[model samples]
Every structure is written in C-alpha cells, then in structure tokens.
Target: MAPAITTLAAAPELSAANTGFMLICSALVMLMTPALAFFYGGMVRVKSTLNMLMMSFISLGIVTILWVLYGFSLAFGADSGSIIGWSSDYVGLSGIGVTELWDGYTIPVYVFAVFQLMFAILTPALISGALADRVKFTAWALFIALWVTVVYFPVAHWVWGSGGWLFEMGVIDFAGGTAVHINAGAAALGVILVIGKRVGFKKDPMRPHSLPLVMLGAGLLWFGWFGFNAGSWLGNDDGVGAVMFVNTQVATAAAMLAWLAYEKIRHGSFTTLGAASGAVAGLVAITPAGGSVSPLGAIAVGAIAGLVCAMAVGLKYKFGYDDSLDVIGVHLVGGVIGSLLVGFFATGGVQSDAKGLFYGGGLEQLGKQAIGVFAVLAYSLVASAILALIIDKTMGMRVSEDDEVSGIDQVEHAETAYDFSGAGGGASSRSTAAPAPAVTETKKVDA
Candidate 1:
C-alpha cells in the first residue's frame, strides 16, 4: 500500500510570527500544570505530597480525552444557542479540516484547540489543591470529569465562545477570570462542603513539606505566565501583548511584596509560603485584567489581591470550611478582585473599547464585571456541589477514617513519596513525617 499521510498548509494570511509564538505559549501554559503540581504537592504534609502531585497529573490525562472527544466542540463550536455550542459539527475535530483558521484568529484551528486545551487541563488541577489528603483518588478523578463537563465547558462557552451570552453582553474576560480561577475556586468550596474537612484541619500543622519546592514551583509559574497572559492577545506583533507582558511581571512583584509586608505585620515574620502564595494571587488577579489595563493598573490590582487573599486565607477558620490549601482564598478572591477592578482601571489605550470607571466610563463595565463574576460563582458552586454529593453518595468521595489517619498516600497509591529505605536496606516508617530509615547497630564494614 502507498504510504498514508496528511498535509497542512499555514493559514494563507497567517502571521507566521504569531503562530510560532503561540505554539511556544501553549507549551508554556502546559508547563504551568506540572508547576502547579509541585506547588500544591510541596504545600501538603510529606506523606500526601505524591498524591497531591498525581491529582494534577491525572487532569492532563482525563481532560485531554474529553477535549478531543466533545469538550472543545461544546465550548467553541458553532453556536447553537447563547448558552452552548453545537458539538455535532466539530466533535473529535471533524467537519473542519486542519487547513482552516480558527475563524478570525491567525493560528490554525489545531493550534488554537491545543492552546485552549492547556487552560482546560490547568483549571481542574487548580481545584485539586483544596481537596488534598482527604479524597479517594478515583473519586477525585470522577469529580474532575463531571465538573469539567457540567461547569467548565458551558462557562467557557458563555465567556469566550462566539455568540455566547456573556460574550455578547461585552463582559471582558481577556483570558479566564470567570472561566478558570473563580470557577475552580468555587467548585473547590462546593466539594469541601460535601466531603467535609481533612481529619485534623485547624488543629493540624498542615505546613508545607518543602518550601524550596514550593518556591521552585512558584518561579516556574511566574515564568510560564508570560505566555498565559500576553498570549491571550494571540499575537505579540501588536503592542498590546507587550503591555500585558509587562503588566504581568509588575503585578506579580508588587503582590509578593504586599503579601510579605502583611505577613511581617500580622505574624511577626515573613514566610516562604506566603511569598509563593502571594505571587500566584498576583498572577490570577492580573490574568483577566492585564490586557485591559496599564502596568500601574496591574500593580494596583495585584497589590490589592495580595493583601486581601493573605487575610482571606484565615476565613477557613472563622467560617470553619477547611479548605486544606487555601484555594478559595487565593484563586476565588483574587479572580474577583482582578475582574471587577477592570471596570475601575481600564484606560482604553492598549485594550478594549469601553474605558473603566476611573477612566470616565462609569459603572457600565463594573456592573457587567460583577454580573459575570457572580454568574460563574453561582453556577460553579451549585453544579460542583451536586456533582460532589452524587459522588460522595455513590462511590464515596472521601477515604476511610483509618486511611486518612494512616496517610492517604500509601493507602491510596501503595507508594511512599520519599523512600529512603531502598538506599540502605532499611524499613520504611509509617509515621506522619517519616524520617530516613535508621542505620542498624552493625559493625562497620571492613573496607
């Protein structure tokens, strides 16, 4: 038989520069998930660290299948209604051949599809942090599959899909303020509500297992976020991409400083965890508003989110919700601050038509921003809670009491996060913070 092959030609008018840039941007965004794995993994107790990392890794697998199957079509296909798109036309990437562009965009359909898929993968992984060390791995996987289907796809349609209601209403989500951070954060809250707290939440130390690893993860995320925020423009030859790139850095740095300042004032010392969390908060806050605002605008937004989220982390105790890793505080609260502030700071130079309230646009954009935030928050909260309830009632969302107390890592995965016994033929310890296997009192080996 003749060799079977397929061919692709660049979109005739495609700016090769943009396509190449976005391909790199897509890879950068993909890296953020693994970076997230490390970030969340390092934050949990040592025993559950591996499981935390796996929670993020699994999203890469599950969401990849769903997106290729029907997720993309439902979110981005030809609009059948203002609420959702028609999957029948583009399921598994059928009907539209690879040669076509993504409508008005310069990138090939395949590139845009994959780039957005990175966002889809990262969003669910963001929720895994809040459920650390408590849920069954199987149940967590199932929750991600269902939550993304019911909440993420439809919300993506509402915000970014052509002819979508929110898109038509002119709510500005340059990247994914509503679709990503807030959506995952609210879902995290809902699941925790259904599943209850990790065994010794408030009383437990629950400190970061590896502050160095956490710092590394934060650094990687900060680096990769350039592509995430600026690439939203989908092109850099335009000056707006540069504006966004600078804004991302400025906002993140400012936020970190603000967070550290808060820590020093309230806790009497700065902590590494606070710095990393502050950086992420800044990134989340800038994501939706970076394109619309100036660098100073970004700094203001980032600083506010850093301060607010630093304080919000304490809400778990006051409200008694037990968000194990503070997902609700940073992502949900940061996303809201960034999205709403655009109404106040959007100066109409680099992005968007309508100016912000501070720029003389009045409350029109502010009202729209609030509506978008509340809409996503409400829908995700309700949908996620229902999904969690179904999973908890069916397969059981949480692990057994013994399993939790014994360490969900080995119970769930039959593996230890950091095995040292293998190096010297010593037995593994089952203690919560298991130390290196001891050297037996053996005579020194004759050398």
Candidate 2:
C-alpha cells in the first residue's frame, strides 16, 4: 500500500465580481462631490454661486494628492497606538502589489485604496457648505489640506482601523456616521464660529437663486448615495449588502415624506427645497446604521432624523452662527440620530452579532454608541476651531468685506455661474433680483 500525498488549501484569490462592483461604486461616490457642488451652488445667492461650486470641486484635487502621498497610510496602515496608524508599505501607495488583497478581503488593495480615497476627498468638501459665501478660496483650499491631515485621517483610523480605540471597544459604524458626517459637521460649526457671520446674516433676503438647480443637484445626490451606502458592505457575498441597499432606499423615502409632512404643518407648504433637503437628511441618517438595522428600523431612523434635523436647522439662526447652507443642521444632527439609533434599532442578524436595546441587548450598546458619538463630536469641534483660529491669525479665512458684498465669484474666480450681459440686448450684466412692479394708470371700467 502506498500513502497518498496531501496538499494545503490555497489562499484566497481575487474576486472579479466584487472588484467590478466596487469600481462602479467608487465612481458613483466620486460623482457625489460634483453633485454637492450643484446642490450648494443653487442654494446661495447668484453672486456667490460660482464660489460655492468651486469649494467642493477643489477638494477633488487637494485630497487626492494628499491621499496618494500619506493620507492612506495614516488611515489604514498598521496601528502604532490606539490613537493612530502608520506603515511603510502604504506610503505613496507604492509599496503594495496590484494583486494583493486588502486584509483578506475579496478585492485588491488598489481597489480598496481608491474606494477609500473617494471618501477622504468628499469629507472635507462637506464643510465647504458651511463656509459658503464668505471664505477666501485660497484660505478654504488651505484649510481643506490641513483639516484632512490633522482631523479626518486620525478620526477615520479611530472608527474603521483594526486597532483603533473605538473599533477595539466594539463600537460599530457601518459606514461613516462618525467619520464622515459628524466629523465634517462639527468642523463646519467650529470654523463658522471663528470666521463670524455672513455680511448680512439677519437682514438679507438670501433666497436660493435657482430652485431648479437645487432640485437637479439633490436628485443626483440621491442616486449617488445608493453607492455610498450599499458599497460600504464591500460585497453582497452574504446578502448583507442587498439588505443595506433596501434599507437605504426605505429610509430615504421615509425621511423625504416625513420632512414634507412637517414642513406642510409648520410652514404651510411642501417646497421643492424641502423635498431635496429631506432626502439628503435621510441619506445621512442611514449611512452608519443601514447595514445593522432592518428596512422597518430604517424608516424609524429616517423619520426621526428628518423631524429632528428639520428642527435643528433653525438652531443656527437662533444661536447666531451663519451656517450658510445647513451643513450643521442636516449632517451633524442626522449623524448623531443615526449613530445613536443603532443602539436601539440594531437587530443582531445583519452585520454582526451585536443587538440593540429593543432586541433585548440592553443599554450596553447604547452606552458604547454614545461614547463613539460624543468622542468624535468633541474632538472634531475643538480641533477644527483651533485650526481655523490659526489660519485666521496668519493669513485670514474670510474674503475682504468688499469682495464678499460685490460677489465672491468675480473677485475670487473671475467668472460667474451665469452671464446675463446679452439678455434684453443689454451689454451690461443685470442683477438677478426681481424688479419692482411697473407703474400703470388706472383705467375706468364697468364696476
């Protein structure tokens, strides 16, 4: 009798299906940056429109360069302490092989790195909404570079990295309730506090110049968010990603309706702007909890977020902070609602075995969720404020008062979003504001 030779099992191979899916998802997320530009651009007065678009578009450049150089390493590299991470292999994205898998995942390291890069690029752009009309373009760009390096990278490591303190403590953030929305929202608050209010915060009629543009941008954002939420699951290998997709849609719809309902009761109208903003509020709320909660749970989360965030937007005006575009209202408050609701809505059947309070998991998970929320909030608020103060002291953060009043588009970019010089056969550009009613003589009529 002869003994048969035995061979060891092969290591995991590349997954073409997952790789292709992720590449598509990454492209979708990339679209969100430009979508945000339009969404914000349409909300500001016509004079500041181009500046708003540029604020988001510029991040696509600044963060991409930093990510390739060192941002990726600091965020995903081997843990140096509970606070930060570093690895020689991840520097310049040059040390890794193309085919290497990302920490035993089905996709290649390149695919994962690029997908994550899109996140880094989008996070700081979110803050641009808060600084909309008043900030100098150069200062905003510089702030993006410095803020991401000091605030975003470390916070990302804290929530998602293997050895991060929060991750080690079993705090769950399915996507980026903590890392993306809350972090950016808090930063926006901090920076706005340092720079002071817009030129005419209370007296001006700063109605959106183009509601149609806002609607268009909001539609694009809704489409892109499917990729943002579903793709965070990495793959649909176990049907978790599919569940996330369903929950994402459910929550967003509920939120839009809830917001519209609230607006109708309180303000007497269901506005186009309300619909768009409500949809975004829903998307923000589901970002962190979509994978952990069921579709029904998602409805509760969305409705609550829509109601709460709708109320929160009014707080800035009352508190005297000029959050030009409601970034703090929606992202900051929505992130808090979603992150904490995971404690009560988590089902233990989805992403992990963790259960929420309603599922008989008790208050333990709620306590953990609270820790993650407040920790990120407190750190981001304080750190971002200090950064803004330093930048303001050194070179100034706001544009000149004259430039801001005349229009930041011309002074900063030398271009306007719309050119009306040729309108009505006039060589000079006309103000976008509506003109006074024409005076006419009263005529006798059969009365």
Candidate 3:
C-alpha cells in the first residue's frame, strides 16, 4: 500500500467534504481548455483560426486519456526518491472507487485523481500558443504526449508527490505557478528558439482577426480560474471560498486598468488585444499566491504582472523569437512575478503562518522561493529541450512552408472554417473582401 493510503486509513474523517469540493473544482478547471481555444483562435490569421482552436481542444482528449493510462501514476503514484513516481500502483485506480478518507478528509481517491487530471490536460496545451502557426498537427499531438510523459509528470512529482524534494524542502507553489506557468514559459522560449521566427514575424501587422473571440476566451478563463486556484485547497472550507472570490475580482480589475493605461501611454490607443493580454497576465500572477496572500497582495500581484508581461511581450522584437501569442511573456513572466512576490507578501496576517519580505520575515522565504523557481526552471528547460529534440529527430515537428501558407485548416484538417456560399467564384470574393498586405508592409511584431 502507498504511504498516503496508510496515513489515510488512520484518519478517515478528513476525506468526504474535501473530495466533493475538489470534484466540482476539477470540472470547473476543465472548462478553461475550450476557453483557451477561443482565446488563441482569435489571435491567429483567419486562415489558421480553426487550426489554432483544434490545437487547444485536442489536448482535452489526448491528455485526458493519457492521464488515466499512466500520467497520473507517474505524477502522484508512490514516490521514488522525489525524482519520479514508481507505478507500483499502476492502474490501481480499480480500488480507488471505494468510499475512503484521506489526509484528514473523507473523499474517494478518484476525486483527487480527476481534479489533477484537468491540470495535466491544460499545461501542454499552454505551450501550443508559442508554436501556433507553423507546426504540423500530427507532430504537435505526438510532441505533447511525449512531453507530458517526460517533463510534466516528473516535475509534478517533485512538487506535489510524497517524498518529492521540493515538497520536503518546504517550497510552496499554492497552485501551479512553477509547474504549469514557468515550465510552459521556459519550454516555449526553447521551442521558439529551435523553430526560428514565424514567417513575417516582425514586419507583418498581424492584427487579431476577431476581438470578440479573444474576449470570449478571456471570460472563460476568468470563470474557470476559480477552480484552478481555490481548488488547490481541496475542500469547501471558508478559506477556499474566500480565495476563489477574491481571485476573481482582483485579477479582472487590475488587468483591465493596467492594459488600458499602458496602451494609452505607449500607443495612444487602448486595443482589445491589450485588454485580453493584461487580464491573462493578472490571472497568471495571482495564481501562485492567491490562497496565501491578502486582497492587497493580490492587487499588487495583478498590477505587476500586467505591466511586466506587457513589457516582456516586446522582448520578442529585440530577442527575435516568435512566441506567436505571448505565452512566454504572459504565463511565464506573470507566474514568476507572483511566485516571488508571494515570498514577501504572504503576511500570514491574513490566514496562513507564512510571512513575506516586507512583512518582517526577512529574505528566508524569498530565498526558498528563488530556489524553487530555479530548480523548476532548470529541470523543465532541460527536460523539455531533450523531449523536443527527441521528437524532432524521431518524427519531425514542423509542417512544410507551402502547407503553412495554404493554411492548416484546409491542408491538415481537410476542412475550412468558412465558405462564401459560392458567391463571386470564392476567389473574387476573398480577394475583394480584403486585399492581402504587400510583402514590404507586413507587421511582424504583433504576430
């Protein structure tokens, strides 16, 4: 029997309420994947919009199956020295259906298992934003499978599993500040480096094709994030409720103001793109510290994330890497800001016993947070790079230039997102609707 099982058997009263609450939280978290689809779908060129949506939506299917098969076992199974999980509990999900209590909470183990499965589904999909336009669909599907197995599973073990080094070291990641955000962010940077810039990256004025779709995505993400962060508490207690509610408002208001303010100052316009990006940045920043800090801390986290991510998104210009949709800028940068800030803002004055640098706890907490950050970054980057290389060498990761230009919707999926109802011979209608920009005038930085 696993150690957690033994401990759980000793204290059965702690399982029921927690398990029920977590089950609901897990379902809420799952909705974000579709929300992500809409968010990314609207950002790409119209020709590839459907393709982008598929990229995010497909993960829900692929990762869900894998999580049941072996992903969960590798992540939360019995520990093997904190580096990875041993599948001694392989497919032992058979007995998990029993009404058992664990961790001083009474709930079926299956509830916890499914809750975590939603996260596994979303993490790899987040990286898809970085490689949006050029990658082959089959290649991406295969890449995520291998990437999750090699990178995500092990890292998750280190942070959440029993006997994991980070867990034993007292590193606090409240949700997935490092595991999901930073890990995806660094991996995005690595992939974009290996893949090179997208066609017409800096020179093409790649405006979002649909602002409404972007707003739709933002709304879904906001709604689902409550489950993502508060669910970490794994119970329906007052603490979880408070965290969920506060996380909702602080992130929204902060991002809305920050994005508009920055746009007015820099570009003399407040674009919808800025609004969507800022909201996501705030959400990312608040994720790690949501449960541990006060409302004020949440606002600070959101404001800083919005501003820092906005600045970081421009790095693609100077550094010349095409993070197609700013996954690295928003998720990775925001995640780091939140994680580090929590070190100084976790004033236990609110609920927990933890305090931050400004709260008179000194740099001890900050040091620990930094260490956790580095360890996660190093592991994720190296592991993800190897996974990418192996997948590239073994199968290939990109599509042909002709296929890309023709659009993955028609070429890859054998379908199109729209049809002009046979009016004006299709060709004339498309050409007349909007003339393609001349080669010299393409806006690359916004792509």
What clash pairs does model 2 have?
none
Best by lDDT: 2
Query: For model 2, what is the alpha-carbon lDDT of residue 363?
Result: 93
Comparing 2 and 3 on lDDT, the stronger one:
2
Better of 1 and 3 by lDDT: 1
State the lDDT of candidate 3 residue by residue for 363-394, as single tens digits.
Answer: 88888888878888887777777777777777
Collision count for each candidate, in order: 0, 0, 21
Runs with alpha carbons beyond 4 Å of true place in candidate 3: 1-10, 14-17, 90-92, 349-351, 422-447
Cα lDDT tens digits, model 2, 93-182, are 999998999886889989998988899988999999999889999999999999999999999999998899999988888889999999
- C-alpha displacement of 98 in model 2, angstroms? 1.1
Q: Which has the better lDDT: candidate 1, or candidate 2? A: 2
User: What is the Cα-based lDDT of residue 324 in candidate 3?
Assistant: 92
**TM-score: model 1 vs. ground truth:** 0.92
TM-score of each: 0.92, 0.93, 0.89
Using TM-score as the measure, name the better of candidate 1 and candidate 2.
2
TM-score of 2: 0.93
